[model samples]
Target: MVLAAAGCSENAMYDLDGGAMDAAVVEARSLEIVGDPTVSLAGGDTADLTVQLRDPSGAPLAGETVRFALDGRAHDSTLETVTATTDAMGLAHSALQAGTVVAAFRVRASADDAASVSFDVAVGDAGFGSMQVTPEYVGERETLPRVVVGLFADADCEDDFVRRDPGDRLQVLSEDDELVRFLGLPAGVSFAVAVRAEGEGGTVLAWGCEDRIAVEALETTDVDVTFDDEPLVVDGSYQTTSVFPTTTGEDVATALEGARDALLPASDATLILDAAEATLSGAEATELRAARASGFDATYQTALESLGPAAAHEALIDRLRTELTSLTVVGRLRATEGELDFSVLRLGMGAGELEVALTELTIETSLDATLDSEELRVSELLIDLSASELVRALATREAFDRLLDGPSAWLASAASCAALPPPEEPIGCDAVCLQAACRTVLADYWTAALTVIEALDQERSTLELDGSANVADLAGDLQVDTLEGSLAGEWTGPSATSPEALEGTFSGERITPPR
Candidate 1:
């Protein structure tokens, strides 16, 4: 009976052990996260997660199926109802992938009657920096009422790139304490920034830019920009080459010199007139009259002799007809006080009379100009012909006929002159004929005088000028409407102390005096 009872006890113990194992499997009612309950991941990255199955006695339960359910969805990776069987260690493994946004998501794991365990995952990047700018103005900030800042992807600041919305721009207002911050900038990318300030009437008061600023992950960059109230001044010299108008075959320089030479003796007559002014009584008066008459005669003779022949007369007239179509004047420029001042120290006309007389005439002119990008504009030009002594010398010749015509005509016809009959008590028809002949010659002198004045008038008025200047060369065109013509030219002068030179050519129709 004792042996039988012992055997029955052993069988009962084995059955009890099997029943405990079955109960343990049925009692696994909860899932617990094996490691950290929360995981952090960058966008487009993944994290491994594990959940353990446990019984009511806190013992591991194997071969149970665990399922995962995510609160949110990503563009990539499986985060829905994913199922995995627990291994011998009672752990089920899964992976959670992050999307392209920065946020937090919840993930829950459960098995049969087990209570679900919740886990959190943060999806985003923390590798961005900040940028701040301090803007400076030449005047008060109040004078600049508005400011705008722009960011670009190119060194030239062209308005393209995807760092921001296409139409979005930044305005740093004084009311906002002038602090600006940008977050989530991608690392290792180049950027450019620009700033502009608006004044009263919406005018742009100041502007500046930073062409290249590299933003790094987890860093901050500081920049400063300045806007100046004063105008920019560019001081430099230029060189040029030129060609003149070829409308007329005559040389322009020769015409000017001829006019000058014709008036030389007449200019000297002023001295004789000054001496005669003091000796105006009886015999002295007679002597003065005779001296005056002789002077008049001599002047007429000199003028006639100068004409040389009919061909010479025509040559002089042809020279006067030649128009200056092209001219080049190169010099240094000093821009300041809202004006560009151009000083032409050297100028050359063709290799004719004008070139020879340049030293003696001292021709010079000043231009008030404005500059834009690569262009130079002449706003006003000051050319003073009266400043030249040679020009002043022309005054006597201009009035020559008025001063000497009467005296010269009287002396030639009344005195013993072969060209007329002897003067009677009153000058008769024969004397009149001789006087008319003399007047004919005086008409030619007047014609020459008028031509010189007309040419000189071109230098006395405002001119329209357009041109451009670059690092290598400078060029321009000058138009004088009153002269009915234009001059185009170019110049070169790289050195400041050395000289800038210019050359140009001209074009125009021949000018004829009114009949």
Candidate 2:
């Protein structure tokens, strides 16, 4: 997220080389401040300073780093230093210690552009005095709040347990060395908190614990502290790499370099991913859960329409079923009565654009289809033409071309039915032979027509064709009315799936061919 001001210096904003952006990137900017030199400070105590970071516009700057300094000194062993990192929320905190202190901060642009911000702050005890030590680590059931947790820490109360009042209070409690102050917590947890020492004990003034807490089943008692007199007590306060039962610290660190054999390859582990698309809904999730068993992949695509014919169509379906049964989610666990479903809500390509994109073969089609898993129920499907290109395709076959060459060739070849019994021919072998020859000649036509009909009847989906009434009966040189019940003019699928044979009737006049 970038913050910008309406009127700020042109140099206020510059692009960062690579950063995590909260939203779209339109501008990059930061804030700068300069304070009057009158700020005062006290010795041996800390104060507070605040800096505003904003974008090129007067708007507050976010994600800036403000280093703290007094005089021209840096974090050398000879000098002390304080620093603050700006947060996404655009706030920075500076610690002021006792003594004559002047506060200032500088921001340097990251790898992207050369941009920077610098500000000066005057320091003094002219501010509030308090110190609060907060636990840095919080796990399940952890009560330490991240907000303003250290706002009221008392600087003087060493060896004190910081407590937040039930009603707007935070204070260091029990700094007396005689009694140890600690917060009582439950079992099975770890915590990271700071403990201070006020007494004149050792050369080491006071120190804070490390980040993060890792506790086994806790003894379920209060947090305790120990002195350098018996430094072994600090061992109870923190866990080392050599935690009792786990491999020693050295072993685990070595494990990162493959020195230890405990690590497993990513592919060897069983992974069950619970994935859901953003467009999917709760109902879809429920349906997906049903498919949880086995290796089903629930997805929807309209590509099935590209399957050319029965042989290819069946083969594609078989592959889909096989793949579905082989995949698994949730580590091979199966759900009974699952529904591996897909929806047609996605784009429909079978109509036109999709057909062109799918294959090299030009599918002269008028088929529009809708199918579900239960049955190949179709809303509409049709075939358009059995014209030249089509006839050649079918007719190229050695034995069956005539049957595929459109209804004209079909009618001509089968017209032997028109012949009547020859008078006086019954007694002769020639007469008997004529009937047999006609049957033999038309045998292929009957087989061809029956094959087409059976396929249409058994097809689970619809197939519409645009067969025009212009097909000419060559023998008579006349165009017959379009085949009525047989639906020669176009393809159609079952009207109701329950009775698969009942299909929509296809009728047409001598329609003009498409341009």
Candidate 3:
């Protein structure tokens, strides 16, 4: 008694003897939920879960039966799944209806020869809540490049939120943004919210956390996070008296200061020595020319002009040798902003004496700063010569005057002498010959003096420090590190140069109140 099968599909064909026959055998190779793996639902709500069945080549395998099942018995009582058949597009649809109680469950889909996928369905009492977070930066409100707002299960946020895994619901806000929203968070339960503010380099600039924040099932929770700069421990008085040049590496401040310190001494010494040489050379040369013109030797006049000037240069050099280079910054960072009393022990020349004085300085602008739990960050530190300018204005004129004053007085005295004697005899003096020699000596003296003034001016404004530094506490003081920048600018004395790399480290201790 043989039966015949009719209307067989492409996946299965019937044999002539009425037995089922394998025609085009297609097995499910992969299965995945059509949409998001996680879904939120209120009590007694239903959501459609769709799964796609695919072959080895990812072509849809139609007419396949996909069984929708729950993983454990815990979810067996709260939620249930239904079986469905794959359509022509290899998609199977199933319905998930939550029970009266609010609970969470995972739905699994299985097909023959295909890996199963899961859907995390969270059921809340009534509905879900949306969290809107607003962040306010208290100091130097620069735009934060990255803001991560995390919503964690109240238990996981008990400890350090930064060390935990990315929370149950995490969302990143756009750069320089002030607000972020997290939608569809499970409601009727306490949650801990943690926010992290980051710079462009992804360094964590600020952190804020709030716990036991409750969200009504249907209401939007408005939360505020304050990233106050006051937490950085930089508000008190700090005095950085030690000028430790930690590295000769690529740092603008170090290179500029170092180059000035190194060059000033050599330059001053060279200037004094050159002044003597110029006076001697100018006097003798002028005497020679005057003697030939006047038909007699003018050696006595030359000796008078060049004598006793060694005492002045010797005193100047001695004063410069005892000078010390030091940096002292005394100030307070009140509410992350304040002015600093800045001073640097610098070498200067004034009033016929070498000046080793404390140069009062000021920054070019207010500090562009941000303070966090770890450190205070400054965008750049530019040391400007407020004191140097005053000295340059006052001492430049006076020093140059004194430089020519002594020489000019000597020249004038020699010129005005009317003692009667011919250039042929050394009994008295030839006033005309003496005046000519004095003129030549004064010309060379003024040239050397001007060179010294220009050299001092060139080094005056060279302390431009570029780059950023992290300032933190070290044994109750401020420790600064990681400074890097370049030193290059037009020399005020007429020279062009390229930037040289510089680096260094310095620390300061609190010397005043609030220590």
* lDDT scores of the candidates, listed in order: 0.43, 0.26, 0.46
Give the worst 10-residue stretch by lDDT in candidate 2. 234-243
lDDT string, candidate 3, 251-327, tens digits: 22233334443323333222222333344445555554454466332334343343322322332233223221222
Q: What TM-scores do the predictions have?
A: 0.26, 0.16, 0.33
| Model 1 weakest lDDT span, ten residues long | 472-481
User: In terms of TM-score, how similar is model 2 to the real structure?
Assistant: 0.16
Residue range 124-226, candidate 2, lDDT tens digits: 2334122123322222212211111111112222323322111011112221212221221111223333332222211222233322332222232233332
Task: Please provide, for model 1 over 191-242, each residue's C-alpha lDDT reduced to its tens digit, 9 standing for 90 to 100.
Answer: 5666655433434445666657766666887767655532222333332232
- Cα RMSD for predicted model 1: 28.4
Winner on TM-score (1 vs 2):
1
Model 2 regions more than 4 Å off: 1-28, 34-38, 57-64, 70-83, 100-515
> What lDDT does candidate 3 reach at residue 59?
88
- Superposed Cα deviation of residue 114, candidate 1 (Å): 59
By TM-score, rank the candidates, best first: 3, 1, 2
Report the Cα RMSD per candidate: 28.4, 32.0, 19.5
